[model samples]
Target chain A: MAGRTARSERAAGTGEVLLAVAERLFAEHGVFAVSNRQISEAAGQGNNAAVGYHFGTKTDLLRAIVRRHAERIEALREEMLERTGDSASVRDWVAVLVRPGTQHLAELGSPTWYARFGAQLMTDPVLRELMVDETFGPTIRRTLEGLNRCLPELPLPVRLERADMARNLMVHMLAERERALAEGAHTARTSWHAYATGLIDALTGLWLAPVTTDG
Target chain B: MAGRTARSERAAGTGEVLLAVAERLFAEHGVFAVSNRQISEAAGQGNNAAVGYHFGTKTDLLRAIVRRHAERIEALREEMLERTGDSASVRDWVAVLVRPGTQHLAELGSPTWYARFGAQLMTDPVLRELMVDETFGPTIRRTLEGLNRCLPELPLPVRLERADMARNLMVHMLAERERALAEGAHTARTSWHAYATGLIDALTGLWLAPVTTDG
Candidate 1:
């Protein structure tokens, strides 16, 4: 039992290293540009098939990377949701929607790769669905429901369009900031907290914007 | 002289075919995943090196594709700017920023790939700079200047941040709509004109949103 426990722990350590390496590489390079063999090699594994052995396939590995981040984001969202508790303000719900990811990036400190990695997944034709399924859970739905309650007059189609706009803005803007920081470039906002605040303000306006034209 | 003209015309036709093929492939598959040889083959060029012969490098090919579209978008923006002409209303400037791309896409009809192709470029780490340089020409800058004129009270950092937000929203939102249309899926807005109107409304709000926090 002792030997088995040690082996399992070692395997877990290797898995963690691989995940970290894969996420950074994916963030730096395009997700589809990097291969499983390259990931295993980068992780210091002698066997090129180590990623396959550990994570099954490329899509599965991509899903694992997303799941790791999504789990933390979901936890953060859950905590924020509890604090929010049926808030009537669109900004409050927008905060609930936006803060978790930014806060998680903050907790991860500078040069974080998850934002860039998530953007890569979101941009990919096949992997977007996986990222969405992993990241957007019950907490997200609850936040959106809260947001919708505040905007009863907004039409459903416009609501949906703005929702897509909000999601795209959130994902890609975070990625842009991450990319800038990673490259030692300047960003307009100094901190993720401030950045999220700006986003919430903008998104609140976006959700509450008058529907000027019919679909 | 007549033979030379015929040769140049045929070459131009081949270039157009290659651009169309490359854009669609890059949209369907990730940009880095598709090769020049594959593009040449798809374009019915006997020489696998035709992409290199016609366009110097993969980056150059990508630029050529962007340039082709940017020319049209620039013309559209120029016309819109002539009409907008120092307008103080944020919505008018927002429409100036949003309409050219959407109007161009509208002209392209169904199964459009430029939005998807451009989104892929924007998501890419290396290629994003190329796309930005190729597309964000003088007209875009003028439109933004006009927008800034409208929001004289907004802080520079918040304005810059919201500018980034608007861009991300525009690029990825159009891509999402194009993707849905390509997949024969339902989109909130049936036409690109309506979609642009919806986007303009949301972006007008985003730009005009109050700055509640310091960056």
Candidate 2:
């Protein structure tokens, strides 16, 4: 039992390092353009097969990177979800949707790459399914259910469409800000908390926006 | 005069084919992942240096692709601008920002790659600058000026922030819809016309949305 625990502990350390290195490379280059060997060498592993050994395939490596961030984000979201407790306010509900991801990035501190990395995954057709599959579950669905309760007047299709808009806004905006910070470009808001506040306000407007039903 | 016209016309024809093929390949793969050689080979040019010979560099090639789409969208926006004529209605101003690109896509028929190709460029760290430089100029600035004239009540920072949000929403959403259409996935609105209407409606709400000023 002790030996197994020791071996797994060492594996966990390597996994963390590999995930961090992979996220940075993927963020800078691209998920598809970077190879496993490059990741292994950049990770300081003498063996070229370190990435393949640690994570099975390129998709699997991508998933592992997503899972690392998603777990933390889900926890943050779950905590935010608990505070709302069926609040009917549109702002509160929208906060539930936008804040967790931004707040998690905020907590992660400066030079974060998950936003850029995730944006790349979301934009890629084949990888988008993997990202959605790995990251979304009961938490996000429940947030939507909570948000839906607040916007009952919105039709089903419009509601779904607005939800899509909100999701895109959060992902892309966060990635933009992250990129700006990395590149030393000016950001409108001073802090992530402030940035998240800005997003919640815009998204609240988006959710409550009047739908122009097609004729 | 006839000889000169024919020479220029032939050059135009090659340029058009190259831009179309590049847009398709960039949309399917990625802007950076696809090389000039691959693009040339797939474009069926016998010369391996066709992209280099014609467009000079990758950045120049990307600019040409953008220039092709931007010219048409600008023409459409110009017509829309003429009708707007400094109208103070927020919806009219917003329509100027949203409609032209969608209308151009509508005119282009099915399986269009510009939206997806543009989205990928917008998301890339380096390419996004070239995209903005090549595409945004007096036309977009004029539209924003027209939009701003109507929204004097909103704070400048919020206005700027919302404008950024609006741009992100439009680009990413259009790309997602284009991807869905290409993949034969179900899209909410049946046509690009309807999709633009939905975007205009949502953007109207976004612009008109009451700002939550950070204290």
Off by over 4 Å in 2: A1-12, B1-12
* Model 2 lDDT tens row, B7-102: 764677876767778889989987767899998887778898889998999889999989888999999999888887754588888888999999
Query: Considering every candidate listed, which one attains the maximal lDDT?
Result: 1
Task: Give stretches of model 1 more than 4 Å off.
Answer: A1-12, B1-12
Cα lDDT for residue B5, model 2?
61
TM-score of 2: 0.91
Show the lowest summed lDDT stretch of 10 residues, model 1 chain A: A2-11
TM-score of chain A of each: 0.92, 0.92
lDDT of 1 by residue, A1-215 (tens): 97796566467898887888899898898887789999999877899999999899888888898888888999999998888865458888999889999999999898899988898788888788898899879998988888888888898888788888888989998998889899888877789998898898999888888888644
C-alpha lDDT (0 to 100) for residue A179 of candidate 2: 91
Scanning candidate 2 chain A in windows of ten residues, the lowest lDDT window is A5-14
Docking class of 2: medium
Using all chains and alpha carbons, the TM-scores for the candidates as numbered come to 0.93, 0.91
